[model samples]
Target: MIEAPLGDPIHHLLTPEALRHPAAAWEPFRHREGLWWSEVLDSWVATSLADCSAVLADADRFCSDWRKLGNDVPDSRLTVQILDSPEHTAVRAQLVRAFRALDWDGVRDRVAENVERRLAAVADRAAFDFMAEFAVPLALDTIVDVLGVHPPEDHRFPVVSAQIVDSMDYALRPETVGPGRAARAALAELTGQWLDGRTSGGLVGHLAAHHDSGRVTTAVLRNSLRVVLHSGYESASRLLGNALLACLDSPGSLDALSGGVDDTALQELVRYAGPVQAEARGCVADTEVNGHPVRRGQVVTVLLAAANRDDRVFDDPHSLRLDRTPNPHIGFGRGPHACLGAPLALLLTRTALGALAGLPRPLRLLDQPRFRRNATLRGLERLDLGWG
Candidate 1:
């Protein structure tokens, strides 16, 4: 098999077809050296686990805020992801406290209830879009409930939030940039209203309290909320879709999951079916990674999904084995910017899987799962299943 030029596959990555079948899309680059410079991305693609980890862990050299690359990122102020430490550290501490104070048991109960309620609605249908009917609703409702915020009257958060995050894709077209900025502005105003009305309890309440105490600023609170809500709202939902598809594709794994496996199995599942495909980081200073020189102002896209499948890291990397131990997958990322909602995501996924196990056995896919057209995020838009 001949390797196409590095830039040739990015257009494919922007489509649902590439997301639905990543192996086929990425197979051409499987043997490419450490970092392939993609003229399309105008950045280097880090596919090895070690290289990706190096880029993510060294924030001093590689920054999370891609705006530093000089692109006009509208509403960039509405997020902390762009801030470097010690600013990032102080703000992150406040958010971490707020997250830690959340009642996990209560959140878990609500999530499980939400999962059951959704499953009940489609339990008898001959065929249903599992993502639309179950996964998306479950994730949205859980996010609202956990944050203790009333659902927006317009129900536009899902669409807007997705667009905002999708705009971060390395393969984004010029036409998408404007809409993403507009979505960010709309979401910020909506969240501001929610924050103003809040008193105590939930995430909004905690943030309000922190703001009152003068520990966190209003801008920080708003931006942090925007980032958390957007990420929390979508990441787990994508993971849920991916994990379910993983079980369905792997024979007998559903039985093992239904019978209850330990956290190791869950970890391995994430290692095998990573949801957050790739993350872009800007080079903060001239540095060397894997002996390759990287200059300041350049962007590096770390392929997390690809790294998780690196043959050097796992035995039979392509196969999903629940018992795989010492799984050091960076599915949630690593170091300072590791996913803040990882525990919550894990709880939600475990709950969803448990609820799925309760479905009538002999489950069958009515059709192959369909993914939404996105490059930065991989998630199902429809998963048709029949159990009768």
Candidate 2:
């Protein structure tokens, strides 16, 4: 692993400005013809649409198990994200089944209910902080239902999730290491409450069955559940707020999605404001990215956000066209390690938007949106909106 000089503090592409306005922030990086080196991760960051797609598709050449490249794995517990193929496939197959087992229609209805409750709570207010009052709790409630946890009203979940958020931002803010670790431990302990293998419904039932059949151990199950809670909560909340922010900004975009959920329009929103920005893959064998040789043991970070707006792939790459067809944006990525929570995000957002459309009066942005300090999961910290 190459190291930065002691005197020169390393810098990264995900700066504070980038986190706030990513679409414009990533413009310069995308302008670069090909792979660029990240001094922080000591890896080549792929920017072009073709290059990012190629890396994600050919997982064998670009392995997800980045540990071989010598950077310490973020979480010692083995989660599906970094596992190599065959093993990843086996685990993923079971997870796909568990996900498929969900009654999406039912889940969508519950999300709608959560949205109504939130909206009703702020009915008398002149304005409400959308991110805090609506987005966060709605997503958390739906996730708790899916996980089959009780006292679904627990406030600690979001509090813990918020604290550890910086942990995932270690790539951008190294100071998050200690606090992030503490937050993760607290989240895991709280999530462990649901690991009793008692719930026989929703996603937890599937885990309980796996435990009963000796397919997975209790410790692994606890880690997996914790990952699901933390990851699922953050993804859904951010995607919810970001999508609405984009829709409201674009002329007639929200109305186009007013009455129903259009998958194509939703995909465009994902491309425009998807939280996941980059994925790091370790080069298993020597390979050529855009004809440039990348030695084995080196890492290639695929910039999904940049590729989503690559002009060669999407015309008017920066604009949101709800009607755009043949949308091949990798907002959820492609191939083996594509986002697992994409379906949940879509369901939550679709239900929320559809419900909001039924309101007696249309909502308007009360103030400029502010983003949380995050690199990968770019999201809003607060978004105030009012019916007046």
Candidate 3:
């Protein structure tokens, strides 16, 4: 029944202010009408659970093309995330096989080891930037380990990867375009180097194996690496930061999880404070959703954060409850476009959070939290934390 003030929808929706305080911006449009047309971007914003699910399911009506949104990154080859329909299905089949072969339990053990090392170094400090000290490295190392990319000791993988991820921030201003271009160029160079013989037993190696066997082209191998590095680290890093913040805020929930939380509890944590908050989709044909008529070429922004907190679906939606049952949150998305690295992400989060919970000094959030200026991937930029 609440409504956003009558104004430029895009400005209100995509600005840094809105992202930092999403609940305020979201309140105006939550349950009234599932979708609203953004005049600035000329897109329809879907702000409810049911509507988002409907749009995601009807991929025939809603297409997933970043190019249509003016992101002309070229089509030398397609990554699994960018592809749709039959092509997507084929590529996923090959990827799933390789993905299945990965030793995730082994991966979790490595993550626990890394987190312990990182935490031990900072245990003595009264306060530290969790983003830099913990979250960033946790995400970066896990990704590097998974992809099996190797480089000289002097090589800055995290720096390059951060550039690629930050450039994709939908909230990036026109002035930031220069940096974005530079980041893309850097990633391209890195991809080229990796393609030119820098391979270990990682995802890149798996793709390289396919490339050598003539199953996939050089372009496909390169683009897939680029996509994985960008998408994989961005969301997971944010989730790490967010999950830590969630624990600091909800001691009860954290205690419940730490004691002996099951998969369902972890799912609720992801639902309550997941990294990815929204997803972008474009309409392929005329369609009707929740009484609103959408035409072809129209953009629809699905608010996953809003959906997670939908009162219609979640009881006491604003509160964080680890034991909340029947929680069908779309944090990782749904259907064909769902996140491929979800299992890895879960392992990383569970391991990292579990390790932090076991720390001797109780973790506490420091003053002045900073949020990243990204509407699509929601997370803190600088989460200061302290322990005894």
- Say which prediction, candidate 2 or candidate 3, comes out ahead on lDDT: 2
For residue 161, model 2's alpha carbon misses the true position, in angstroms, by 1.7
Which residue pairs show collisions in model 3?
A: none
**Model 3 score (lDDT):** 0.71
lDDT of 3 by residue, 1-388 (tens): 2223466444664565665555565666666465766555456778789999988777677767555445565553366677676656666666676677677777778898998999988988988999988888788788878877753253575665555545545443455555656765566556767767757577766655665434545565566666666666777888878876776777666666665447887788788778787777877778788888887777787878888888899998777787789999998998788888888778778888877776666777778678876656777878888863
lDDT-sorted candidate list, best first: 1, 2, 3
Error of 3 at 238 (Å): 0.7
lDDT of each: 0.77, 0.76, 0.71
Ranking of predictions according to TM-score: 1, 2, 3
Candidate 2 lDDT by residue in tens digits, 65-84: 76666657655345567676
Instruction: Evaluate model 2: give its lDDT.
Output: 0.76
Q: How many backbone collisions does model 2 have? A: 0
Q: Count the backbone clashes (under 3 Å) in each candidate.
A: 0, 0, 0
Q: Which ten residues in a row have the lowest lDDT in candidate 1?
A: 1-10
